[model samples]
Target: MISKIYSSSSIYFSTDDKIDFFGPKCTREPSYNYKLSGKQDGDGGFWNTFYELDFYIIHNCTNHGAKMRQIRRNTQYAPASALFVEIKPWNSSITNQGQETAEFF
Candidate 1:
């Protein structure tokens, strides 16, 4: 299996664990809609902008999936740059559909 990784500060919310992608104070809000990419130990650093469809929250995991919805020409932030990504819990049901269907048969 391929291992994918991501870099992000641990998310802290005042309410339930359910984080809202568009809510106030969210790190992924419009003004802060930027994310970082690349391997953590190597020379991996890049930035990408966010859009309406690039929003999601993952549970029980930190890694997220992203698409380059918008590209920016500026790199003023440099190494401190970040990239917002959409994350969701791995759906076991979706992953095990084949076995589940066989059991039903």
Candidate 2:
């Protein structure tokens, strides 16, 4: 048997214990759009960005299962780096296994 470990802040967990990727202040409907930010703008932190990367790999299967729809770079006041990845609506075989082979790039 194999086990995988995911590193993320516990504060991002939902009430049901799932990862709260979008977080409490999420401003979009359910989709691949991601807004990763820290406690303050220009805090020079990459915590949420790391989680976004994790979710990207997990959802896209090593970047082979989805296409990037849009990406917004972060600024000092708007420190959240936003991204929207588009995937097939009916891809029932998406292997959410990239976490098992996690790598930081």
Candidate 3:
């Protein structure tokens, strides 16, 4: 996914720009402890920290993916274009399931 984003025409980055693939620094106790001694804190488990970071990455990816889709459609298809593309009512069913899983996590 990071490679795709980097290679995409819609994405641009400067030399000074830094992309932390995992979103940002983990300042939580579990992450700090795990990194320091390869052990998670008793109260704040590593899995919890991992879940938060995963959520952050997923949220950003979803937003950017939607924006890129919209941009591609705008550039490749005109409003007056008579393209015969089949639309499916269940196209979003998978996305809905993913959202439900994310919420459950």
- Please report the candidate that would top lDDT against the real structure: 2
Candidate 3's error at 92, in angstroms?
18
Tens digit of per-residue lDDT, candidate 1, span 9-30: 2224422221222222223222
| Number of clashes recorded per candidate | 6, 0, 0
For this target, which candidate reaches the highest TM-score against the unseen true structure? 2
Work out the TM-score per prediction.
0.15, 0.17, 0.15
For candidate 3, the per-residue lDDT at 13 reads 48
Give stretches of model 1 more than 4 Å off: 14-105
Candidate lDDT values, in order? 0.24, 0.28, 0.19
lDDT of 3 by residue, 1-105 (tens): 111011112223412111122222323232221111111122213322221111111221243343211111111211222223221112121111223122211
Looking at model 2, report the run of 10 residues with the lowest lDDT sum. Answer: 68-77
**Residue lDDT tens for model 2, 20-88:** 234222222333334332231221264544232122223333236443122222211222353433222
Error of 3 at 26 (Å): 18
Candidates by lDDT, descending order: 2, 1, 3
Per-residue lDDT of 62 in model 3: 42
Higher-scoring candidate on lDDT, 2 or 3: 2
